[model samples]
Target: MKLRERLEGKRMLLTGVTGFVGEALLHRILRDLPDTHVVALVRRKGSLSGRSRMEQVLNKPIFEQVRERYAGDLSALLDARVTVLEGDLSDVPALPNDLDIVIHCAGDVSFDPPINQAFQTNVLGTEQLLRRILDSGSNAHYVHVSTAYVSGRRRGAIPEGPVEHDADWRTEAHWGLAMRDRIEETSRAPGVLAKLRRAAERDHLRAGPITSAQDTERRRKEWVDKKLVEAGGERARSLGWTDVYTFTKALGERVVEEVGAPLPVTIMRPSIIESALETPFPGWIEGFKMAEPLILAYGRGELPEFPASPDSQCDVVPVDHVVNATLAAASVLPEPGTPAYFQVTSGARNPLIFARLFDLIREYFDKNPFDMGERGAVRLPIWRFPGGERVERTLVLGERAHKAADFLVTHAPRGDRVRKLARELDQQQRRLDFLRRYHDLYRAYLETELVFTDDNTWALFHGLDPEDQREFSFDITTFDWHYYLVELHCPAVTESMRKYDVIRRRRGRSAPQVAKQLPQGEGIVAAFDMDGTLLSSNVVETYLWLRMPELDGQGRAREVGALLRRMPGFLNAERKDRGRFLRAVYRRYAGADFQELERLVDDSLSQHVLERVSAAALRRVREHRAAGHRTVLITGAIRPLTRPLEPLFDEIIAADLAIDDRGRCTGFLTRPPLVGEARAAWLRRFALQNDFDLAKSYAYADSHSDLPMLRAVGRPVAVSPDVTLWREARKGRWPVEDWKTSSSVSRLTLPGANGGSSS
Candidate 1:
């Protein structure tokens, strides 16, 4: 049963030879029937018209295997006997002469198809191809790919044969297509004539005319819908098809059944086909227009609370099975006058219930966890199920948010959003500039997902005899859905991510000369936000920072002691997450002097930031100096408390310090202590005046409050970030790192002044 023996040197023409099903079939045809010349439909070489579509299908891994299997270039075989007619399917199907088999798999597959396109390809285009077979004067097998749902109104127990047509109901969807064509034609016609007529009116607002062509093909829209109802919902239920795709597919079936004569023909009805488990290479699929959304929702962890009866049937099959079945059907094609029908499905006969499918998914996830990016391998506590009503409530809340924003814009923060967006845009531009300046060392984060189905496909080849099935047994009954869903899907993501990483790393290596090293010298103080940027730790409630002084008027409840004193009630209150309690416990009203704070900082250094950094980050600090960058620590931890960090850098800048009469503390800052705008602007001015280039600087920070400092620097990275910081970083396209273990000193801290600290 060699391929050369099967085709007997005859030529085969295929319309969607580059498509998912077609590509696999093309491979099968060429592999099993080597002597069979493949006349694949390819667009003109230099045409920009369908490049995206063409490249996506033709450049598949299967096609590569086809070329390799032939032991030479596919182009050579094509040039010799496999003719590639370059033309659009919508145009008349001008096919090659003298073909043995004509497998048509091209055209629209989406349920909600844009109009004019459905008939052009699915119905009329198919009709044109069949005519091409007749016109070429060659007896070819018309292997038309029709949907299983073309059964129209047939309910249960679909027979494995052509739907018996009643004498009265012969012409099915042709009437609708004719009606729709006119509507489509009128919709595209010149509305300018009407506009011109209006302009020529006796007494109108005569400033020429105002028109941009919007004419409703109302009669057409209504006609098609009525026709869909008449034609039945087989197309709807089977393919989840809308009026456009279903009626047209129904039309395709009727047209072929009526007109496909004087030639051998077989219509294949493929149900929901999914990823290949064992046949060919695993997980081979093209654009997932149908199954993609579900996959995307799953990947995003949004499908955890979906609406589906656990007991509902979920039939799926691998694509290779369909290819095998199609081939077998082709091999045993009945002579002209007799048409064969193969319902390649895994419906109730071999049910794969929703519960079983979900269990498989859960099992897959349990064994092979999906990468959560920066979130780490998460056994994320399942979010509380918010029903459909809750989702509506969220939508309502969204409206409320919009209203609040509108009110705020009208009242206080007038144009604040505009200003904020502009500032953000400017910052993003600077980051891009930096990345481009050092192209080799920078990268843009690129992400993509994989989705597919294969049920009728597995049964496609299974329709053949036992020996044939053995050779091409692509059934899914024995498929390990869990392993496939987990392993098959995750690899695609991981491999794509790995490739993306490689591309980005290569890009990052192209970083500008200045990006390689920070500016050196003692005078060049590159001040950085301690929490996220320079040092890694939460400035707010990090376990270490929580031990800092209370800073109440007395200052007696110092550091850990103060925390311990308030911990019992605050812990209870904090669990409720109220604003007032948090504010009272966190914000320092009466502050400490620079000197006294420094003393406390040095004394309690180990309890504060010092114990946080790992050995690796400490090494990075040394590397920073060796690279000639003058590092300085900057924080919002009140005054002299920041002084303990001085020894690790050239200088330290904290919230301004003030002292009263004789070495006692002052409640308020000495000057209008820099924060937000004042902080970043001051740093920028200092860098400019001190010959330090903001364009060549780098800063890191943890909290959202320190975002200004991070954004001001050329390279602003985040470490152990808060939600706000993480989102802003993404929007701003900033780098992020989280070295928060004992092995890495990324967030190092020095001892505090005395036995207390203010972090």
Candidate 2:
């Protein structure tokens, strides 16, 4: 019988209609089997109703043919032929009395999900659905969609049959489901909490106590999740499976055999399903799947080498082929109390090795290369197919070196040069992290030697009528690997990525601009960080510029040599306690004539301070002043250094050094340094005293140590931020900008001045 003839008047219930294969299957059934009634089981998401979600799915490009056939009245057709069920496999809803088939396609496809999540969706959910089918008393053919990798860790030809195992499904399900609570309980132990808390403090050092506490809790949950993933993977490997996903799926197959007895069951397993071939248009795909990330990374020149043996069999099938095979399997009802198995894969028939696949990908990318930002078209790398172990070792060593470089760059003095280096390192780190993640996830599958035998599937295909075969063909023997990948799949994936890039560009352009959207009022204050925000020069540089001029060239050389010798200690002290670092740096001014120093700073203001000021930052300050908003300069630099820029701001809150009766410097701060929590506290007091609304005020800073100050205001911009501040800004979704020093201004040299100042 033809597939449509068998399923013409069938009442079917389908799960996983929102996923890649599930969505394509749904489109095929609705378009081809018009007379069939389908119950689409979908879980409600947030505020969207199940019916609305299904409508969204039907509106996708895969359903374009269906939409055209129905003359845009797809909604009316859906009303007549489809019923949207607002539930999942875990909680099966009431089924129609005369249901003919139940297609369970939903599953967690993640390789290393938390154990509890894996079992709840894959094993127990299947058990619940099977039990529901038994209770419904409908003699429906149950089609269980599973992966071909369920043969787990086995080599050679894998036949279409039950997986050999020594463990009980019930016991495995019990342990997997109960692991979450155990991991959560362990995460709350005193030692664990302390460790997590310390890490959180280091990450969110200047983000205040409340923010740090919140981060600690977030870290605790992440730790629990990580432990759960580790435990699940360990359990899977112990039971001879590659990962938790395959292990739970194997258990789910056991559920179909044991709990789903007396009901006609057909288990259909497909291997590494990719883009569509013909049905619902060629090259149709949803989100990025198993192999797309690796392919895209290679095309982008981010991945340098492939990590699989050249001759290893890569068993891949198109989504449309899988969909057709599923429909074909649904057509044949098995004998009562006996389940049939079909492995819908191409490995045993026309196999495509890893080498050929890589060649095809490279060919496609060579013709139409991926855009590499400033580098234009990416030049594809020559893959040596180095073994997985070698590639992994190289990535590990690179990551360790990256960490050491990161440490050195982070502790370097806060300046434009260091900031640029930090940004470059951040980009490299992200790329390396991406390579590591995909390598770990796909290494086993790419290197596996198992070739799934699809004898049962081919037999079933041969039994179909010629016309039916023409209409719903899934013959892997006739599948052209070259045309499908180079002509269809690669183009489709790159097009999708291009669309995403467009959306990202639009979002970036739409980000909030602080200067253009400032409110006008005295209560609205605009706060700016002096060192890296307004001026490219830091406290150390400003001090050297002022103090070095007062001494001869020998004194200047001696001062710089001493500062370099103590630089590491200063950076260490700054990391441990900001106030101590400030005190130590200011002690160099002890015994200096305060009046002479003040005069020198005033004389050299235009050369040292004004020349280094960022033009964009100065314009923003002027805009705030013009709008009648109070502008404040908050800095850790001493008060004398800020005297030059005093005219731009209404208030200057900087460090003050103690002066003796004769105007000699005491080098001791009269009050604690305004940094971290102290800066936030002082801002709150000032806002209260001046009747300003902190919620309506604006603050800007570049260093991570100014995070508390940034959080204290409504509008906080990160100006040419360091690595730590950049991460915090991204996480908080705060505005980030790179304000360069005024380009038109030249570096001024004072007559008889010695070496360059340190920054």
Candidate 3:
């Protein structure tokens, strides 16, 4: 009989039906091999019954063709031909014993999942399934779906066969046990307990001061879990695997060999599976898979750079190709002995290089850039693939820059320009760190020259009759990379992204009037610093020195006296470590009612500070506002102080104190204070979001602390004369206008003055 004829009337037990490949395979079998009965394993999810989940799975777009052929009555079709087994591979529940074929497709696929969770789903789960099949005395031909990368870091032509090194199952078991023991031991260790205590203290300051024994245990467990994940990554890298998923999947393959030795077994190793080429529907994908996230990130101008070598051969195969190869392998099994291995990969024949893939992505997105609503279109960033070595160098540079920035931000004055640069540098450093870690995880694969050989796969296909070959053709050589990627893959990925809100497609004219009028381009915004430029006295210091005493009513004298005594120490701290001092001062207000604090700050600002607003500085602000430019109050001052001045500016960006559910101050900021280079970063984001023209915008400040914000705009003006500001403004040839009552109305025209319009 032919391959389809052989599969007809056969009872096949399929695992991971909800997975990408499994869903495709299920569709193929049900659609083509009409007589075959399938037994699918589905685990119960929260609130949803197992059968209900399976039903939902069948309704997915992957099964669109199947649904259409059956007129959307998937339940009726499944009821007649498939058995929804409601249990997980981790469980010891009874499996469908009376089976002709068993396809194990379920395995952990997460790049960096929790260590124990990866082990349980990928390794232990496979072992349990194998045990269930063997112990039931079922004469099923087991077809285990694994990955070609399970060969790990082997170079050159990786053959379609068993893994290179012999798996030590006992050693793996012992290591797992030791890891479990370590987890339990470290969760209660003194060092861990101390870390928990520090974390608890921070939590108390942020939220309410409440911590239970259970809360402490939860924190301890979280720490242990994080450590376990780190250990798993380290272990996987040491053993030549990319991540826990691959490492554990390799272990699962070993277990399958040991446990299913007596049964007829076939191991089908497929490469990176993309969307379906010619099955189900063209470009049918579920969630984002493989390198799609990177693709999306690049298209949206969010990705920094591609770290891999552009010329590296991406060993990718269509999902349908793998499914066909899998069914073909199962149909004609080898003599009852060691498991038959067939690599279903595309590298040997239809190899698509990373450079080519990236080109296709660029080509697709170039035509259709992602829209960010009123923020305008994301400018397609320069596509940089500096390769591995340059990426490492970039990472090192970023780290150094970050360290320097951190030090400056900590030691520099509260509202200094150096602090803003530091914060911006710090953000760059974080992105670099993330990229470095990502590079480390996948560096081996990118560097590897491995081309997975599919000799066995081709031989199996050649053994079949012409009719059978035509029925289930998995010829890797026939795959057209350009057609598959450009015409189908890229478009499909973009469509899916839009569906999931990963990209916001431009809405039609029917969109809301408010959204339409949000402004998009060529509009200017003027950012003004409050403390030194607009106000004569520092708002934060003034609040502490004068207003805070009023808030303490009866203890006014004691509190004011205490603040005065601490003033010298705070000043010393300001010169030494400003960040720490800022945090310390904020911590004093923890647990204070937010509403009461707001009222006090409002009273203080209007009564004492607002009258002190410089006349010249106010003129500059009014000029920008009168010119229909967006006026922004960018300050290092507290939000409550800025609130009273909100009417003067269209947007107020400042340090906001964290408030808990009870409307009490949490002694911490809701986010990092927008000061220093951070202010500049915020402006850039604000300009993007509000469609402002930063190049045409203006900035006015008294202190050199507003350097970043000033540098960001086209017209940067020094409002008042501070020694540092005067010197820097003179050196850089930036406009200088003293806003003091002494020089009010008369603007200082320096040597380079060409009698330009001041505003």
RMSD of 3: 13.5
After superposition, which runs of candidate 3 have C-alpha atoms over 4 Å from their true positions?
68-75, 196-222, 372-386, 399-434, 465-468, 499-565, 568-759
Cα displacement (angstroms), candidate 1, residue 678, comes to: 34
* Cα distance off (Å), candidate 3, residue 220: 4.5
TM-score of 2: 0.88
- How far off is residue 359 in model 2, in Å? 1.7
Return the top candidate by TM-score. Answer: 2
Residues 1-759 of candidate 3: C-alpha lDDT, one tens digit per residue: 688787888999999998888888888998889889999888889988778888887777656766787788977878887898888987946866688899999877867776777788878888888888888778899999989888887678998777766657557655754786788797888887887877654322211123223446778878777777787777777888777767877888888788888888899998889988888878887777876766787777766666777788888888988988899888976656688999999888788777787787777777877776677777776646777888778778877877776655544553435534644654566566656666776676676678889899989888877887776788878758878887888788888667655423444322121111223333988888887678765634545532343444446557668778888887665433334556667776788787866665564435344555777666666766777888889876767777668778888877788999999889898877665556777899999998888887878777554566777887677765344444456557676655553333222211111212121
| Model 2 root mean square deviation, Cα atoms | 4.1
Question: What are the per-residue Cα lDDT tens digits for candidate 2 across 308-364?
Answer: 999999888999889999999999989877899999998898899999999999999
Query: Could you tell which candidate, 1 or 3, scores higher by lDDT?
Result: 3
**Considering summed lDDT, which 10 consecutive residues are worst modelled in model 3?**
750-759
Give the better candidate number (2 or 3) by TM-score.
2
**By TM-score, how accurate is candidate 3?**
0.66
